[model samples]
Target: MASGSASLMWFRKGLRIHDNPALQYAAEGTKFLYPVFVIDPHYMEPEKNAFSLGSARAGLNRINFLLESLADLDSSLKKLGSRLLVLKGEPSEVLIRCLKEWEVEKLCFEYDTEPYYQALDFKVKNYASTAGIEVFSPVSHTLFNPTDIIQKNGGRPPLSYQSFVKLAGQPSSPLSHTLSSLPLVGDVGSCVISEVPTIKELGYVDIGQDESSPFRGGESEALKRLNEIINDKEWVATFEKPKGNPSAFLKPATTVLSPYLKFGCLSCRFFYQCLQDVYKNVKRHTSPPVSLLGQLLWRDFFYTVAFGTPNFDQMRGNRICKQIPWNDDDELLTAWRDARTGYPWIDAIMVQLRKWGWMHHLARHSVACFLTRGDLFVHWEKGRDVFERLLIDSDWAINNGNWLWLSCSSFFYQYNRIYSPISFGKKYDPNGDYIRHFLPILKDMPREYIYEPWTAPLSIQTKAKCIIGRDYPKPVVLHDSASKECRRKMAEAYALNKDLNGMVSEEDIRNLRRKLKEDPEQEAKNKRIR
Candidate 1:
C-alpha cells in the first residue's frame, strides 16, 4: 500500500517456501511481499527444424508436476500468513512492470543451474537495478556450490561419478542455511487468481496413466518419498542390485526421487543430510544407505558442470564429449526412435518412456549407448533431444554427459568400452519377462525365444501367431557388426584428427562412413543378427 513497503519474490524452480533462501530474503527485507510464477513460453515453443521442443516436451512432466506443486505452494503460503501472487509471461517483462506499478524495492529468487536461466537472470537483474530493486539469488538446492566441484589434471569437471565422488568427499563440509519465509505482503500487485497451465494446455498432451500418476509432486510429497525409501530401511538391501532387470521396469525398487531432485522439490543437501541421519541408526544392523546417496552425489556433479557453462543444454557445451562423429543414418535413427528395433529390451524401454514419461537410469545408459555407439556417430544431440522429450526426469547435464562419454568425446573418453544391446538383453532380462510385458505381440513366443522371436522355429512362430519379419520389425541392425562398423568409422575419423575440436572435421566424418560401407566383415555380421 505504501512506497518501498513491498518486496517481490519470484518463485521459479524452488517452489517450496520452507528452507528456501529467496523466500526468507524477501520476508526479512521488506514489510510486504509479492510472489509470482512466470510461464516462459520460450521453453514450450518448438525448436528450429525439430518437430517439438524435445527438452520442453520432456519438461512437460515436470511442468505438470509443477502445476500441482504450485497449487500446493499457494495453499502452503496461505497457511503461512501469505499467498503466492501468480503471473505468467516473460519474467523480466512481468517483474519490471510489476516493480514499477507496485512500488516494490527488492527481488529475491533461487538460482537456477541451467544457462538459459543464468542469461535470463542477467537480463532481469539489469531491469531490476534500473528500477531500483535489489536482486538476490540464494544457493539452496545443491550440496556443494557449482564452483566447488572440479576434477584432476585441472580438467573441466569430472564427467564420471567415480571421479566426482572421490573429489566430493575431499571438499570441506557443505554449508547449511537457516530456514525462514517472508511475512505476508499487503497491497501487492493485483494477483492473478488462476492455476498454472498443464503441458497439454501449453501444447503438449499429458502422459496418461492406466494407474494414478505415480509421482506426487511438491515439497511435502518429496519429503514423503524420501521417508518411504528410508522409513524402516527395507529399501537398503534391494538398492545394491538396482539394475537387475534390463527391460527397465526395475523402478520403485530403485529410488524414483530423481524427478523431485531435478525440479528442486527435494534439495540435494537435505537428501544427504537425511541419509546420514538414517545411516547413523542403521550402521550396525545393515549396510549404510550409501547406494542412495551416491546417486544424489551425481545430481550434485551435473549441476556443477551445468552451472559452469553457458547454455549447458546445447549439445556442444560439453566440448570434451563433442568429438563424436555420430552417424546420421535416417533409417536406423527411425527404427531406434519408433522402438521397433527388434531388440525387445530396447523396445520395452522406449515404450515405457512413451507411456510413463520415465525410465530407469540404467535403461538410459543401455539405450543411449546403443544409439551413440551401435549406430556409430549419430549426433548425440539427436539422442539427447529424444530423451528430453520422453524422460520426466531428464536433466541436460546428465543426459549430455553420459551421451558424450559413451560417444568418446566426454571427459571419460573410452573408445573400446561399448554396450552390446544384444548381449545386454540376454543378460539383464534372461527370462524376457520384462520384454513380454511391453511387446505383447511377442508374448506367445517361448520364454527363451521372446527376445529373438525369429529364432523360434517357424512352427513356433505360427503358434505364437506372428512372423518376426511381418509381426515385429526385423532387427533394425545387427549388434556385433554394427558395433565393429561404428568403431572402424570412429577410429578412421580420429586418425585424421584425433582431437574432437578440429581433428575430426566433416571431411573426416565422411571418410569414416565410406570406410564402414566398404567393410564386408561388419556387413556380414549385420545379416546374422537380423
Candidate 2:
C-alpha cells in the first residue's frame, strides 16, 4: 500500500471504471498500474459438437457484447493514460506470472461469489500471499455483498422476495471514484501484454458484427441508456413489471438495461441511486416486487439464494428444488428450441431470442412455462441450458433461479397457473403484430386466425397464403389435453413430496422418476383402483 509501489488490477465482470473500488485502489499512490483482462480457455474453447463463435455455453451475440465492452473499457482507460492488457490462458496461472514478471506489490480486483471465480481467486491469493503481494477484492457487481445478506438473515438466504427485501434493507449509495489520471504500466521486464483480440482471433469464424441487435455493449452505451431512461422521471416513478407490454418490440415496455447489468458495464448501485432520485421527486411511487427498484432487489435475491444453495443450477441434489418426474423428450425439446412449436405466440418469442439475444420478461415467462409444466413437460435443466447459451442478459444465478421458478421446481409453487400460449400473448398483442414481425410466414394471416391459424378454414388459409400443417407446422401437442395431463402429474408429484415430508433425497427422486417412466399407466391405474 506504500506510495510508488507497483499494482495490478485484474478485470473480470466489473468491466467499467466508474464506482470500481478495486480499480481505484490499484491506481491510487502507485508508480505503475497494470489493468489486465484474461481470456480463459474454459470460456473461449468450443464444447463438443457445438457450433458457435465461442464456447457453446456462450453464443456469438454474448461474445461480441463482451469484446465490445472490453474495447470500450480499454478506450476509457487510455483516457487516463493506461490501457487494458489482454492475456490469453488459465486465469490463476496467467495472473501469478504477471505478478512475478511485473514485480507487482499489490493485486486488486472486484470480488465475485461465483464458484468458478471463487476457486480461481483462492489459487491466485495463495500465490500472492507467498510472494508477499497484497491482494484486495471489493464487491461491486451487485448492489450489496451477498455474504452480508446471508449473515443478516441468520446465515441463510431469504426464500421469498418480501423476506429478502426486509433483510436487504437499503442499498448503500454509489461510490464516487473520479480518476483524473492513472499511472502508466512502465517497465515490465519480460511480460508481453497484448491488446484486445478480435472475434476471429479468439478462434471464432467471423460471424459478421451484431448489427441487428438494438443493444450496443459498452460502459459508454450503458451510461447513455441509463440517463435516457431515467430522464423520464414520471415513467420511472410508475414503472410496474406486470403492466409492461411483452409484445411491444420496437419500443419495449421496460428499460432494456439487463445485459449491461449482467456484464457489469452498468453498476447496480449507480442504477439504484438513479431510481432512488426519481422516487424522491415523485409524490408516490411503486415499491418492491413490481417497482423498477424491486427489479434490482429481485436480482439480488436470486444472487443470495444461489450463493447459499448447493447445485442451485440443477434439480438433482438441489436442496430447494422440488423433485418431479420431468420427461426427457429430445424431439419435443428440439421443436420448442428451434421455434417450431406451431404456436405463433411461443415460436415468435424463440425466434426473437435467437435473432436479438434479448426478449421481454413476460415473453420469457411464456416460453419457459411452455417448455416445462405448461405443455411439453420437458426438464427445466434443458430450458436453462438454452437460455444460458442464447440470452445476452444471461447470468448463471438468475437463469437457474428463474428456470426453477417457471418450472415449479423451486421458489414458486403455483404450478396450476399456467401461461396459456394462445391467450397470454393475445392479451398484450391482440393484433398479433409482434408475431408477424418475428414469424413472417404468418404475416398475411387475418387477425381472427393469427393466434390459432389451424382454426381457420382451408379457403381462409389459402387467402392468407399460409396453410397450417403445410407452410407452418401444426401444434406439437394439444395445449388443453397436454396442460391437464401436466397439472395432474405435478399434483401427484406434490402429493408424494408432501407424504414424504419434503425429505426426499436425490436418489429417491431418481428412483421415483424411473418408476414413473417405466410404469406410469400402471401406477395411475393402481391409484384409480384404490
> In TM-score terms, which candidate is top?
2
The lDDT of model 2 is 0.87
Candidate 2 per-residue C-alpha lDDT over 297-360 given as tens digits, one digit per residue, 9 for 90 to 100: 9999999999998889887778798888788889789989989888999999998988788999
Model 1 poorest ten-residue lDDT run: 51-60
List CA RMSD, all candidates.
3.8, 3.6
For model 1, residues 1-530, the per-residue Cα lDDT tens digits are 55667888888777775567788778774678887777666654333454333333544454566677777787788877788776666777776777777787788888776766777889888888777777888777677666666534163666556666666663223336544344666664364534655555666544466522457678788888878877856455335534445454645446677777777777666777776677676744333224676666666777777566554554443344344456677767767777878877788777776556677666777788787765434667787878776666767667766666656655555566777665676776677777777778887778777777767888998998878888987787777667777777667655655554454455655665665578676566665444
TM-score of each: 0.87, 0.94
Model 1 has a clash total of 11
Each candidate's lDDT (Cα)? 0.67, 0.87
Report lDDT (Cα) of residue 11, candidate 2. Answer: 95
Tell me the spans in candidate 1 whose CA falls farther than 4 Å from its real position: 1-4, 42-60, 150-182, 188-193, 198-208, 211-213, 241-251, 284-290, 309-318, 375-377, 494-503, 514-517, 520-530
What is the Å distance of residue 437 in model 2 from its true position?
0.8
Residue pairs with colliding backbones in model 2 are none
